[model samples]
Target: MTSLIIGVLLVVGGAMVGIALDRSLLRRWIRNRDPRRHHPAPETRAASSRRRSARHAIEDAERRVESAEAGQLSAETAASRVEASLDALQAGLVLCDRNGRVVAQNTAATQFLQARHGEALVAPVIKDLLEQARSGELVTTRVELHAEPRRSYEVRAGPVERGGEMLGAVALVHDITEHDRIESVRRDFVANVSHELKTPIGALSLLADSLAADSDPEVAAHLAGRMQIEIQRVANTIDDLLTLAMLEDESGRPGARVDVGAVVAAAVDRISETAEQNDVKVVLSNRTAATAIRGSRLHLESAVFNLLDNAVKFSESGGRVDVVVEADQQALTVSVTDEGIGIPATEQSRIFERFYRVDRARSRSTGGTGLGLAIVRHVALNHGGDVSVTSREGFGAKFTVTLPLDSGD
Candidate 1:
């Protein structure tokens, strides 16, 4: 019995140790699973749940931050593209606030501002123009800039308004120096034409009165012949003027396709008699074979005839005039070279201008209306080409007419 009791006590002690070890393991697992339980009583099961929810909320916020960063990057890229495109435009652009302060500017605007840098406090001109624009009075004025080179600009300023409230002003500038010069020249040409026409008409009128009053046969005959020549001159000038006007008008009209070779041949034929009378010969360097250009047939023929006539008139007795037609892939070049009293270098540039002559007395004696070269130039330009002259004081002159082979239109 004593041995049995000892064995039983030993078994009970082993079971108690096993139970304590199991409880210790369970506590350790609970502690590892939930570290918040180590806090005071305030951190209960509900508090643990709240902490878990807070962690999830923080993770959601982090995800939103990453998404927002991506969106910001896209917006920045779009803005950069817009800015780059705006910079590429040729027009000047400026952004200003309601107070007429320049807030933003493009490359064109910056360059324009720099050009006007010498004006009163550089900023004041812009401010004043903007202020004037805001007052409902759009200012359109021409401003001259003296930079490395002189330039004329037409500056236009207008208001930018929203809901009847003045926001700012936008200014646009155009370089019109060349345009202005052309307009000036056009005005002078009109005046010159009026004066030229008046002289012939007045002379014809005076001669007609004299012939009507005079009963002498010889005097009347002389005056009538002179009047007839003047009338013919007037008619020729009017015809040339009309031809030039038609050439300068809109294209795609009737008689647009002109056989350039035929026109040249016809001009040579028409001037054959005159060439013989002046003892001048017409020599054609036939290289084009035959090519057609888009121009008024009559005008083209007249242009060629004018060139040939001028050559024959200016050539010396028994001088040979060469007419060369050089046609290439891109352009057709018609050059009329004459061995005559060549034009001076200083007068070459203005020879093509209407009523412009190197020697007025000589041009009048030659019976030239001074519109032949001008008409030729107009025809060349209308056909998308240009006319150039190279001459020395003693050496002969070469007048080249370059016309595009193909009309891209």
Candidate 2:
């Protein structure tokens, strides 16, 4: 009976121990499968999630850093291009910020700062224009500065705006000195041409009427001669007007080589008859020189001819006129010296002007067109040369022409 009782107790104990072990294993499996049932599993999962999140945050930060670097490079490139574009403009350009303060300027814009009197005239006006632009008013103005050489400038500026917001202002300055000069010359030319033409035309009309009305042979002959003279004067005036206009319109550079010595000789020949009629003697000197220059042959001949003719007509009887040609390494010079009625000092400044004459009565009597010296000036300018006169009243006058030495070979 004791052995039986001991066996039953052993079986019961073994079965109980097996049930407890299985229950413990099942509870562990449930906890591992379901995160809510086990707190330690949830903690492990949370640690892994935090690590992933940290890695993702690091990647996102790297992407943002790269984007910022690219944006900076793009901005720098755009700024460089803007600077280059602004500097290339021919007209002066001034750039201002929204506050109307000058932030950037081009090389040409700096010239306004360097100028003496021009700055005073230009800066204040520009500032005013800019301020006006800030008020949304577009302004354009031309300012004439009476400086040493005299200058004219056109300024155009206005506000730059987008989306109803004023961004800044832009100013453009253009130098118009040459244009103003051309306009002044044109006005003077038209006035002079009309005055000169009307006088000759009126004289011709009166002389013709007198010739027609007179019946006496002697009177008729005198009237006819006078009419002829008046007609010639009219023809000369028209011819001169045409010539001056042609010269004014000529802008092409002379490409042909011209022998200045040859030109002088030709001019002397053309004026020799007139010189002899006036009892004036023309003497040539220094003709055997290498006086060659790049010039228009026709224009040069005309200039020399006019000079010689003027010298002859202004000279008194038995006076000697000298024609000199000289050449050196740097220049070719031609001088016409006349021992005749000379120009007064006060008239020197206006000597080269068109239709200007020191002795109006004498010029008219001699059939002078009053455009000879002006023609000479135009020809000199065309050839990149200059002409000057040295004279004193009642003394001889010397007219000198200088041309840069250019190889005509």
Candidate 3:
């Protein structure tokens, strides 16, 4: 009986020990799996905390990547919008590196390249230009291009910088052909005016000195007459100058609506004396009645008289000079036809230029100041019109002045 009791006690003790070890193992498993579970050992708890922190950090990094991608897309969209806006401008634009290599260019730059014989668009013709610009050289120059129809351009180059560091260069090209032409015309006008004024002044001075020195009444009288002629020439030149100045002034001045019939009649009457003196017959062809033009009376009369006078002076003796004034709803045309020693083709283009004469000797003999046609041109232009001439050498000449009818009328 004592041996049996010892065996049972031993069995019960073994079962209790086994059950307690299984419970400790289950608690350890729960601590490892559950994040909120605590450990009795400090080292084990710190290791678990480190693992949890590492996992959280990994997840945060993934979220940051997604946000960065979204921001990157927004930035790219804004850049695209900026590029599109620049492309719509009319002016040509180019962005280049400091070495003159093209980075970007607009559509106008492409068109300019194609127009200039397939030259590389946005590329520098000379690398020195880029280098100078990078060095802060603000240079401007006029360049003539041999493109289709030809062109004149003003090119200006300057440096582009950011944050005090040299970035690159920019070149701006502007078409200045019309401006150049206007400047050329201005220079020519000044030179011509100087020449015209000097001639009459010199002639008057010489004639006056001769008259003062000549004691013989016949010689003095002849010199005085020559001086008077020079004075008249000077006066005529001054009047033409003043008239041209007035016409060129941008100020709008009121003028009378003179009857076209009266203007023609007056012009005919004024030129009849000159025609008789030159032995040329004047013929009038009035096609339209009640024809009127809006212009200063003096200007219209002077322009018409100049045309008739030119016809009479150039015509041969007994040659017929025809004057016609006609009008339609749109415009009025005044034509003066003369059978004369017609102007040469080469000289016709320059006849209307101030002080330009086809035949200087003939012009002097006919007492022409060389400003009549010029005056006619200015008057026509001021009245929103134009004058044209057609002449065949040794045949005849026809001058036509066309003026637009008043819009309100």
* Candidate maximizing TM-score: 2
RMSD of each: 7.1, 8.3, 8.2
Error of 2 at 171 (Å): 3.6
Model 2 lDDT on a 0 to 1 scale: 0.83
TM-score of 1: 0.67
Clashing pairs in 2: none
lDDT tens per residue, model 2, 32-120: 89956545587788999999999999999999999999999999999999888878886778878889899877877777745666655
Indicate the worst ten consecutive residues by lDDT in candidate 3. 1-10
How does each model score on TM-score?
0.67, 0.70, 0.68
TM-score (C-alpha, index-matched) for candidate 2: 0.70
Candidates arranged by TM-score, highest first: 2, 3, 1
Ranking 1 against 2 by TM-score, winner: 2
Model 1, 258-309: lDDT tens digits are 7787888888899999999999999987687646877777767778788888
Write down the lDDT of every candidate, Cα atoms only. 0.78, 0.83, 0.77
Candidate 1 regions with alpha-carbon error over 4 angstroms: 1-78, 81-85, 88-105, 109-151, 155-172, 250-259, 275-281, 287-297, 314-320, 328-332, 341-365, 381-386, 403-409
